[model samples]
Target: MTTLRPERYSATAIALHWAIALLLLFQIGLGWALEDLPKGAAQFAGYQFHKSVGITILLLSLVRLAVRLFRPRPEPVKDGRAQMLLASAVHGLLYAVMIGGPITGWIIVSTAKVRLQTMLFGKIPWPDLPVGQGFHEPAEVLHGALGTIGIILIGLHVAGALYHHFKREDVIGRMLPGAMKSHGVIGIAALVAIALGIGALICGRLLSFAPANLVTPPIPLPSASSEGDIAAPMESTAPEEPTAVVSESAVSSATATPWKLEKGGRLAFTAEYNGEAIKGSFSRWDATIVFDPEDLPGSSISVTIDLASVESGDSQRDDMLRSDSFFAVGTHPTAQFVSSSIRAAGEGRYVAKGTLLLHGQRKPLTVRFSLNIDGSRATASGNATLQRLAFGVGEAEWSATDQLRDAVGVDFNLKAVKKAR
Candidate 1:
């Protein structure tokens, strides 16, 4: 059998050691820097990236520890009883802290009260932490403290390795990786890792779909007689003329009262995107709106958007929207409005908020519309923005250099004329 040398690490071990070293340093720096950002989209993005990287490192560390335990490592020529024991203790603690820190952090994140994206490569995965009480807050504090402990351990580990390599001038410095030194490969590898990281981030957005369970809009009327005690609507944009349409849920036994399409109803809609101007309102939709105010809580608003009937008079723009980018009529077939909640805003206006469920994702939207009461017909209109990229509605690529805005402003006018028995 071939004889073993004093204390030089093998190529694989050295590479792994260095990789973990760099990763730990990066994690500490990024985490500290990210904590300084205000709680918003910037902080949200940073937290997501930090959590992802931490989980990755923790998994890698576990695997590395297992490898170390099974395989034999080079014994240092000058290794003493005290030095060896110290190294073993330090490494064991390091592994424990790394694993525990991230798990605690994840627990903290899962319990966050804000709407932040908690996804894995764009898949809206459930949080791994327990959902209730005292455990979570304490876990957050522990997560923060343990992160520092990990950093200190890494610093100690690195310093000790270097001391052995330089001060002792031992076999520790002669690691196989140190022997075959190359600048190009390291640079290329770094570039590739960064590129893939960015790509994964971008592509993740497309894959993730987290639906908001909103208070759904007024259920359509099966018949006036089918009304149960109408649940107090969360909000309502329907007029207060003693008629509210019965909620005709597809799954429920209630059959919606058939409404005749009315022409000349006014339309309104709005759009808002991060870092872009709040663009809104182009009312060309004139259609009939009808619903009984007394039956309001049970009635769901339905809109039949006449694409060809659109008279913004901008043929080229309308055609582009109707084609693939905006409406994508060929597959989606038709565009419709569904309300989620109908809470009163003020005066005659109520905030009708809900999911657009566009492209495929249920996009959260809110429209402030007026409820005009005139006989059997009720007119309602409002505005909301659609962030295109957030929902994978378009490529967002304009030209070679110019990038289009992530949001598209949509305006719609809706009139509901009360249908007969």
Candidate 2:
């Protein structure tokens, strides 16, 4: 009589099985963490990461299903018809939840009112499905329902595996690698840990918690004088205009006279969060211009912006913006721009090619503006688009371009008075 060999699953099938299992666990934990986070950069990042991992799971599950359809699987263990039917039903349900959960999440993202993109691992751009915003709430409800179903199905799957292993059946061993031995105690213990983790997550004990109140102390005012009287204000002096002789020369060599930013100047940027536009400004920034519209090559400009001075009207969101995951003000407190070249674009329009150093990264930037000079006073209005990711402004979880866009638009309206030579 010839000896018969026991069948085992292919390496690909086994690999996919374990990969999906681990990823699903991670996804579940991430989902819990995401829900626990308060609405800010941390929560925003958690949501993106959760979506990324869910998408990964979705892709892997599809591949696993495809592989199962095309490749051979281990023969079913010898068991009663009822037992076989139970096993098949359990597996079918597992696959359904695994695939359905991510699809529901995708639908939610696609239909969300806020236009958000999905980035795979914070690098590859993943587009949302072509779905209308009307479905967002419905899809969100479905996603939550699927998640609950997934937890139950996972529990049943683990119980079934334990039942087979404790009964000394060959089913569990068929999925294990040839080099590894299967023990009922070890498998049951692992399942118990997973069960406890799931229970803790459901009970809101892990990672999820309400945010504490954040207090921002008021800035201290200058102390009163020893006599208990406030200091007198300095006498104001009006800016002196260039003399007629100097003005005549400046008309020829405009680069010889420097320009001072006037009181009405404004610098602002627009950022998108959750499909809404957020407008902010750097309250403290200075610009030095040595320019002559007549001398393009000789003119130069330098701008220094205090990152900590950012104000977006919302205190919580402002604090989050200053956190390490976004601007990282503690490490890099200022951003700068220095002009390398200036060229006339049209009659009154000009383009300044420069290098912007932001968040410790330097990149070439161009600002286009139309300048109007009325003798001694000048005005410049311009806008530029900046890619936040290029400068590492949004770090780690904030790196997702879908939730927080990579492109930020900067606009400035500067009124400057020309200084005498």
Candidate 3:
């Protein structure tokens, strides 16, 4: 008793083969589309989906290989020796790419600069490869090279199948999903076209997928300024026609000098993202200062910042920062600080203790600043460090400080002129 060779592959093998093939084409298209997308929540989700598909291809390819080994397979087409060798080489390379591509991609995510956890389809958490940082760049290069090779091999495989279905008329029927006979030339062309079109359509749909349903409010556009001034000056002149009855009781007893903020003032911040500095600035803010260097008890200062006016040079990142996960500007559009006390620290340095209201949280803050007065014009610069998490700026998964650090540095520079009585 002997086992007779079959004319068609086992149903299981056929299903896996077609599944992996379709996935490979779709994956390649997706990889290219990822580069075109802006850096934001939408792109992040797209990448996760790409990873999920790659993992799926790897599992299915492994199962397909197992089936080929244990189960009886169709006899190979008795073609020329050269054709047989070509087919064998292509098949071997395809298998290598199918397995290696996803592994390299996993390594990339594991050792990424910004280590984000891979969530499969935003549901199942996939563990990263146990790898180190230096592996990321090489793996990325290798992954891209493999994708290029895979595309070329797939084209060759498709061309071979079409040739056999037409010229040889003996090879393609074994892999056909069902008893689907070609009606004519139109039918054969249609079959090939469908195979090609499926992946493109899938890729297009994935690229256009909408982001999480979080409303990102529009930031008010700041007025234009010259290169010398980053922030537009917030100053207005008094009207000449105004005449009112004198009210000496309304004025304060302390005769502290009022300083008007001049142009070229800047309010900037720096935060660490994966050990890299992300620099940004608030374009809209106002300050009130009444100070006397000799009379610290009579001096005071206050600041109000429009949080929605933050610009980090990245539109997507700016949008994300304005969203609920971070600043949540829609809920708390402004942050204010009112000084409780001011003391002279050194010859030119002063420290102002204040209460800062940010992200709906109020906390004590100490600001150290250096002041220089030249006749009536004055210049001041200061810096402060604040914990973003403490103020409830980062919510949910974003609250974790591994990717984005907790401590953020805020710095400001301003020029002012004394207001006449």
Q: Over the stretch 260-358, how does candidate 2's per-residue lDDT look in tens digits?
A: 777766778898877889998866666767666777656666677766567787756666676556776545557776665667777877766556767
Which 10 consecutive residues of model 3 have the lowest summed lDDT? 222-231
Give the candidates in order of TM-score, highest first.
3, 2, 1
Which parts of model 1 have CA positions greater than 4 angstroms off? Answer: 1-7, 111-117, 121-127, 130-132, 169-171, 174-421
Question: Model 1, range 232-334, lDDT digits (tens) per residue?
Answer: 2222233222223333353144233334445554443333334544432222222222233344444344333433223233434444444445544334423
State every prediction's TM-score relative to the real structure. 0.44, 0.52, 0.53
Give the root-mean-square deviation of each candidate in angstroms: 17.9, 15.6, 14.4
Backbone clashes under 3 angstroms, per model: 50, 0, 0
Candidate 3 per-residue C-alpha lDDT over 186-255 given as tens digits, one digit per residue, 9 for 90 to 100? 3574487556656564664466635323223222211101111111111112122121111233224556
Roughly what TM-score does model 1 have, to 2 decimal places?
0.44
